[model samples]
Target chain A: MFDVSRVQKELTECNRDKAISGVSIALYEGGSDLSHLRGTITGPVSTPYEGGTFLIDIQLPSGYPFEPPKMQFITKVWHPNISSQNGAICLDILKDQWSPALTLKTALVSLQALLSAPEPDDPQDAVVAKQYLQEYPTFVATARYWTEAFARTSVAIEEKVRRLVEMGFPEDLVKSTLDSVNGDENLALEKLCSS
Target chain B: MAPVPASVARQAELLKQDGNTYFKKERLGAAIDAYTEAITLCPDVAVYWTNRALCYMRRKEWNKVEEDCKKALQLDSHSVKAHYMLGHALLERQDYAGGIKELEKALDLGRGANPASYMVEDIWQVLAKAKYLEWEDLSSKHIYRMHKLMEACERALTSFYTIEDSQVQNDCEEIASERLQQLEFLKDVFGKAEQDDQPKEVPDYLCCQITLDIFRDPVITPSGITYERAVILDHLRKVGKFDPVTREPLEQHQLVPNLAIKEAVQAFLDKHGWAYKMS
Candidate 1:
């Protein structure tokens, strides 16, 4: 059987230091089960993706910890190694090189690292990879534009969390629930009550 | 057996001393031989069998350990080492229920021993793993059964609307309500198991890095990193042939039972069985 207790432990460990780790995990919007989760990563500094708050959808297989957790970008990202259409990442660790030693936090950090150093050679999106290799300036502009369009919701979510916390919900719970609902205050409040 | 001759008993004592020396030096093969000779000279001595069981345990000859421990227990029913070794042997063979019972017996026998004796703590360690394994297995099966019952309830409720007869429909509705309450009760069991959700985190090292759950059977690698035994074995077979962290070439045989960590985990659970519903 897949180890749910281990997933619970990793979730606790990963979210212990959210500010320092620059990554966090929460249950997906409507699911109470532990297998499905949402991961957030602060885009690495000095990269075009920097300052962006990226959301990754995490699905743990039954052979999880033995198998790599399936991760995809929910918030659209423009990187050579990430498919712009569907946000599929072509990272080795998530595939053949997966190790049980690596937690979801490490995988998210690796994703952030992939953002900083995009591998255009082994590309998930050939169009983006071509832009990255042949037209570096255009690549940077498109990546930055995509980040601005899709990933700059950290401040908005923070504002929503502040409002929800003011409404007497616990800050951490409100924060996670608010982000998962995509900043819809009414949906978050409804979801929080049920959760 | 009849009382032994004095010189023959003395020779048996001398062989036991030789076995002790061999055991201390980690020469389990020679220790087993010495203990065998000691048992041959004085078959009634319970410790001679238990000591040889230890040597067998060290060699991972679990069946031999089981046999020797059984013999030791038959000779001296109060032999704690016999129960402990037998329990461990049973666990190695996946007899969790029997292993847990034997470990509990060992615990009952050893709890009031002197401060210098570590047998109580050792028994607690094995007991803890045994209990945890049993709890995890049973709880998961409980969840699966509850889900099936819930699905049955849903189907009955859905079909309740389609029934032409009012009497049958009312009976179906009643059963559906009972099933709903049953599902609630099952959910509450899970809720109660996780009752202490505030300000408690399992210590990291007590957990396997792979699964992050508490160790069931911990095995240490050549590089000193430890993992839950089943997890690491799966990694070796399904993933790669090297250590995940150190990247050192590792084989299945190189993984040694990490008794220290296993004991620590067992101790922790023994103290806080309420946290995980380990009892």
Candidate 2:
């Protein structure tokens, strides 16, 4: 479980700050006992994601404070740091910027800033990152496309992987085999599981 | 003992070679003795540490493996095999994150970048057996056999499954039963290998991609060893042996890491903000 007070304090601070806009936030803790901790962020006026109500999922690590909590995008966006398949956000602060001095409000502000101007050089999504670096326009267009496709009602990759699995193959084989085949979900499970 | 002869270095090298030979032959006990003797003769050499670490690894003495690997690194931090063995030792100890770091270093130092194809068949067998165990009941061994038979039938749903004909189910059941028995015997003989041996099935291409991914860093090739930094290049060239029709290196068909997986893995490092180096 996380320090709920700290998270709440951060949420309140972000809400009060007008600059931090256009993002929705939600917090979850205690893996099995998942009670909706909180969620709220408005879309920013500036940036490509402007007018977009981006949903953010903040999951506290089993050991919070000592370790950093997880922050992912629940709303689909074409950011270099977020996976298009799943709204997995790649943030340095969330992972490495874990100073006790930094609060959830500060993290939210950072994420909002990231939306305005993504660090193309240091991207979480390599494909997007690479394209962003090499061909900036294409990356932006793709990001926009993905945002339109996924951000409207963002879904998780696990659901997609599960859907593939339900087609008759074992989950373990599906994942392992899909990885080797490099995202080809239609691969025959028999060939993958064969000795 | 008055003065160390020039031949002493040569003698130590010879002993070290002998230890490596034994290590390769899987005569671990002898390899250990030979490496020990070489170390006793010349305590400063790095290869001696490497040779002894291999022996320790064969014996499953992970602590000693780590100790020897560290010693080798201390003597020569650039030694690729030293880092590779260190990664293996760390992995055996279930220090996955640490092990991964060491392995990344090993590739950076020019050791084999990816898990070799040699590891695939064995790893698969192990995974299959584990899956078998999981699917099999704790209550009855015979019932377990029956379940495995059903599982094999389901596997036959695709053309990739080799078993054919009307009696295929019974034949598969018989083959699976015998193999499971043999596997149990092998486990007893080897004194418990890892549960899922399935060769990490890390594709040769993935290994190449990972190698390219790690090598793409500017810091990797600072001292004019840029192209040769990732050991995967050599392994990739060697993958020619696997192809009979080509009869030459499969240089063209190889998949280089496109910018995405590279950035993702790098982001993983950057996001973790974890610091790591070759040593």
Candidate 3:
């Protein structure tokens, strides 16, 4: 029922257009019958993320044509517009710049471009972006550290949370709190404190 | 009379409990299942879908997140959780412009309508998360309220300006000029562009594009170029690359930022001298 054909077509185009380095696409279907759409875009060549592969998870709406699909980074990377813990990107195209004309290809390309030229002035990852522009070397090292630590792997947040539940936390409190934080452990703990 | 299937309601309750637990634990995968089961048993319950959307968002499972949020909103548009979830979903999907609209809606009904009120600090923290200050400056307040207040103030000022006969109609510049000057002075101490913390003034050329009747689409500029689309079109026409008479390009006109203002600029190519089309 879902039109994965568009995603396939875009992947082919992206692979052919080799300028975009290590980006790859995957579809995670059914662990709750949740047809999770996932993709990875490798950092551009010669940047801090040169060898690093960044993960992006996409969620298409039922009304795909009329409403915009949602996307966020799965693997953590240090970037101006992406959150360090959850990889929540704060790009305008996904927010305000969307038009019917834009395709997944363009969005991916824009993301690649974003990494190449991080807009530190308006950053989702304010601390990271701050370090990026203000202390280029430190930012580069930190990015490399994150890529080595977080990206280049597929660690599920739920997988960890499930493990934590087994340890001791009351299941209801854990899931609700974790779900509230969107499955990022750091954010989950943060939410836990206040909740 | 048929015997009551006590397990059905019990199962639904368990699922709701599991969903709630999974939600807190940050195990969205399990939470989604729990919520889905609850929805299957009781489709009419608004909180089921609302909770499910939050799980979907946790997994970055966008489509489902959106559907659940929409369903929750459908059940009750006034649901702040639905509005907040929808905003996050849209924001994740790079529909920031739409997300902001949704966030503004959530913010407007005050804290009661939204689930994000639980994580109020994060909401404010994330507002300043985006790079563009004007895009969503949570530092000030909800943008919609600001717009509404600005509109009311502008209306009052417009009447005053009409009486005074100042040339600039609804001059926000005239209204905030002194405040802006003070802010500019503060920028020197604060180190304006260097820190990227302060709200920089939106440039005049950019402001002009916003004022233009045709440029009303709620899109942030793709390229942060100084030249507006109209200005670019006008420049292309002046170069004769795009014939003003026919209003069509001789060839596909491609423009980029920061080269000479003119690229492959064609000017005064005499049609009479040898440029006529061959019959």
Candidate 4:
């Protein structure tokens, strides 16, 4: 069984300095299960991933703290060490190098650090890694584009939905379309038009 | 008949004596009541609070004991009884680090006050328990810190064993020995975790494709892919009943323990224990 008390303590500790740490954790919306959580981490400054707010799905195993937390990116991003297709991170701390002392906040901080420093040699996405190593400028441009295209869109959902509705699409349809395309206004409009 | 007038201090003294009498008679509630009355009469006296705390301790009321002890300490910081009681209360509450600090302070004050009156051996025994408990809490967190705590436990154990008090010696020895066994188990687990901090390349075949860690108990799936038994079992049970690498449909029974690979991993671990930390 999961140690609910420890998980509760970790959640409190992580959220206590959410503003300062730029990382916060909340209970996964559907249920009261403390084992599943939703985490948010602001991208580190002075990096291609900066100004992007990343959402992460966190699942705690029964042996959590003893066992490493299962974390994957819920928000799309472009990084050599992170799978562009599935968001599987290639950080050691998420796997065999995980220590029980590490909390959710620290793990998210590490993810932010990973954004700043991509280890292309130990790549999760081979194509991205190749691009990163062989076409440094192009890789930076593509990563910056992905962040702008995917990451920032979540913040403009209200505006996007309003604009789509003003363009004669139903409010509910606009809302669902925006969510389906991860809050991308242009894509949601195209999806609405196509439907 | 002569009318006798008692001063507030004298009245408090009389009440304290009554509390002591009740305490010796094992009437803890009555003892507490008497101590409360004494405190009401002499709020500035630290002894009343310490005496009440002792009564609370007898009743196994750790929080009450802690409160009274804090009150006593506030009145007179040098009160050894207050420190001792507070340490005992904190220990009972499993605040080992805080308890240890308070006990250490009591020991220091006890030394200055009167060495003969100090329960030196008992304090050492409690200190050892606190150190061992602290190590237990830290073992899962950080291997290096756990190693340091283990060393602290060892030092405390050594000191505990040297105390001349024959009354607690046997009990302390038993506890110390048990703690040592626990420490050995933790050492085995943490020794490997500490190695993770250092960069060491393992032979590729030694690592499980699923976990990317050296195998503890290697097992082969029907798909001909080898993995650590625990990792594969976890994947099968939770994630999916398929090969993590190949995505081939699989089941638990399809897993056969690869003894040859297991033996190799064992030999490797036996040779270099530090490389086997991911338990």
Which pairs of residues collide in model 4? none
Q: Which structure among the candidates has the greatest DockQ? A: 1
* TM (B chain), model 3: 0.43
Kindly report which residue pairs in candidate 1 clash with one another.
none
Highest TM-score: give the candidate number.
Answer: 1
lDDT, residue A53, candidate 3? 66
lDDT of 2 by residue, B111-170 (tens): 222444222222222222332333332224544554575456445443333444443655
C-alpha lDDT of candidate 1 relative to the true structure: 0.83
Candidate 4: residue B5 lDDT (0-100): 37
Per-residue error for B205 in candidate 4, Å, reads 44
Docking class of 2: incorrect
User: Which 10-residue span in candidate 2 chain B carries the lowest summed lDDT?
Assistant: B219-228
Reference-based lDDT, residue A29, model 3 = 35
Q: How many residue pairs of model 1 clash at the backbone? A: 0
List runs of model 3 lying over 4 Å from the truth.
Answer: A1-21, A29-35, A154-195, B1-279
| Model 4 misplaced regions, further than 4 Å | A29-31, A165-173, A190-195, B1-279
Worst lDDT run of 10 residues, candidate 1 chain A, spans A149-158
CA RMSD, predictions in order: 17.6, 24.2, 30.7, 24.0
lDDT by residue (tens digit), candidate 4, B99-192: 9889877855653233335454355456546754564445446665767877786677556655734545465567767767866776676677
> Which rank order by lDDT, best down to worst?
1, 4, 3, 2
lDDT of 1 by residue, A103-123 (tens): 899999899889999999999
lDDT of 4 by residue, A1-195 (tens): 755655776677689889899889998755788889988888788888888888898999887655779999988989998999998889998897664435677888999889989999899999999999999999989988888877787666687778888999999888888877778777878889989
